[model samples]
Target: MRLRVFEAYRAAYDKSPYAVAFATCFVKGGASDTLAQFKIERAESWDVLRTVKFASFSGLQTGCIQHFFYNVVFTRAFGPQRTMLVAVRKTLAECLGYIPFVYMPNYFMLKSVFNGGSSLSEGLGDYVAEISGIMPNRSFASRVWLLCRSAGPLC
Candidate 1:
């Protein structure tokens, strides 16, 4: 079953990698948000709208951006080589460029738009508060720790 699924994915990816990437990220976003709501947040009911927002943002924005980053940027820079040096360089590039520059800004913008106040100034304020750890009680790391604790002792 897994092999068949992989084969199907491979076939689809070969034809339209960007579409596959979008779909994959969409599903991932939906699933992760669902889990967070039910398990981590411990919501009594589903928040379908939140799930939709997450899926849409992840699919429409991050997916295409990631596809371009990996396929175009990294491929052009690193070539087709799969050596240790190339692998390290690519990893460094992803860490240095993608995480800080692309991912965090998009993530914070999504957070601002959805969770924070209506106005742009309010959103920027929220972003500043979050980044500067001014909202100590509502820190991202605390949430992650809570999530890890919920998972099990192994965490």
Candidate 2:
């Protein structure tokens, strides 16, 4: 359940350029430490068992690697000869990283949410409302709105 929500949040952000910025922030601000702290705090607050699940970490790293490979390698390797296969592979790889928890469960949940006629924008709005309760700042709302707008009408 928690993983599904996190994946939804990740997918919402992944469609926007903010993914790059978020990745940069992760790298520049100390990825391991920040992620560890986040896991620790989140686990404590949410009472999540197995807070440092190996599969979850693998999924997160896979997503990071996919983004890096796509932006750095795929763009250069394929150049103007992009194909549907390449795009699908990239998208799948990102999904793997974005939704690490309950692999099949998360995938199906997202598929149902997205394919059931709800717009990505609606999902993002819900995400923003949830996050606002935790962060409670103007900038967070501004960032969410900016990212949603950048993600287009569906997002």
Candidate 3:
């Protein structure tokens, strides 16, 4: 099950060369510190998600790494909010500059598949919109909005 989810995530992110580069940057320098930072950020996001009644093991599994590197690092450095959801949205928007917009939704979709007994594409369009709104930047939000517009509703 873990392997399946990981493979799905890898496939999604691997589609983008920039994501690969960012991931390489994350892993090569300060690997241990980066991992520890990731873990702590994951725990923080889990705590917030749990509080918000949005908790899911799949969300944790898929989003934790992203929440760590993307959300935590950038937010700590220059983003407006320190909260988990805020960080996530900011990170998603920033990543959209580098990776395909489908990547994040696909990650959530895989989580839904593994943990929620849903299709890989199920509920993705909505989730993408929600995340886009949470993002601070209008440019990235517009891009995500365009993607969501093109994506037909998924049942």
Candidate 4:
């Protein structure tokens, strides 16, 4: 069953990167959010709306853009050569360029746009603090990325 499922996913990914990426990202986002709610909020039941909001943001925006990033930007810029320069540049560019400029802002926007809350204004500081909580791991993760040399930041 597991092998069959893996084969099916591999076929889907080979057939349509966009759809596979979107679906995976959608599920990932929802699952991560669910885990967060369970761990942090101590929720007894699932929050379907929050999960949907996360899915929409992750699938429609992040997944699509990330496909371009992995297929075009990272592959073109970094390539498979795996030089120190490539690793350094890719890490810096992804960490500096994408996380702040592209990723987080879009996340906030999507959260605000979908949920219609004060995340932009009043809750901004809270979000920043939240982001700061996971701040240090990025360097290590990027370094691991250098070793793995996977598809993209997400992949």
TM-score of each: 0.71, 0.24, 0.27, 0.67
Among these predictions, the greatest TM-score belongs to 1
23-61, model 2: which lDDT tens digit per residue? 544454354544565775543343222223332333344
For 1-155, candidate 4 gives per-residue lDDT tens digits of 99999999999988998898899899888989999889989999999998898887888766878787757788787785656766666767776687666777677666666777755653455457777876666777666755565333432
In the range 56-137, model 1's lDDT, one tens digit per residue, is 8888666778888877898799875766666666666775577656776676667777774475456555566666664345
Ranking according to lDDT, highest score first = 1, 4, 3, 2
Clashes of 3: 0
Which lDDT value does model 1 have at 113?
A: 79
Question: How would you order the candidates by TM-score, starting with the best?
Answer: 1, 4, 3, 2
- Candidate 3 has a TM-score of 0.27
CA shift of 154, model 4, Å:
13
How does model 2 fare in lDDT? 0.47
Stronger candidate by lDDT (2 vs 4): 4
Instruction: Report lDDT (CA) for all predictions.
Output: 0.75, 0.47, 0.51, 0.74
Worst 10 residues of 3 by lDDT: 49-58
Q: Write out the backbone clash pairs for model 3.
A: none
Which residue ranges in model 2 land beyond 4 Å of their true spot? 1-51, 84-155
Q: Write the residue-wise lDDT of candidate 3 on 87-128 in tens digits.
A: 455545555542345446656675566456458667575567
Q: What TM-score does candidate 2 get on C-alpha atoms?
A: 0.24
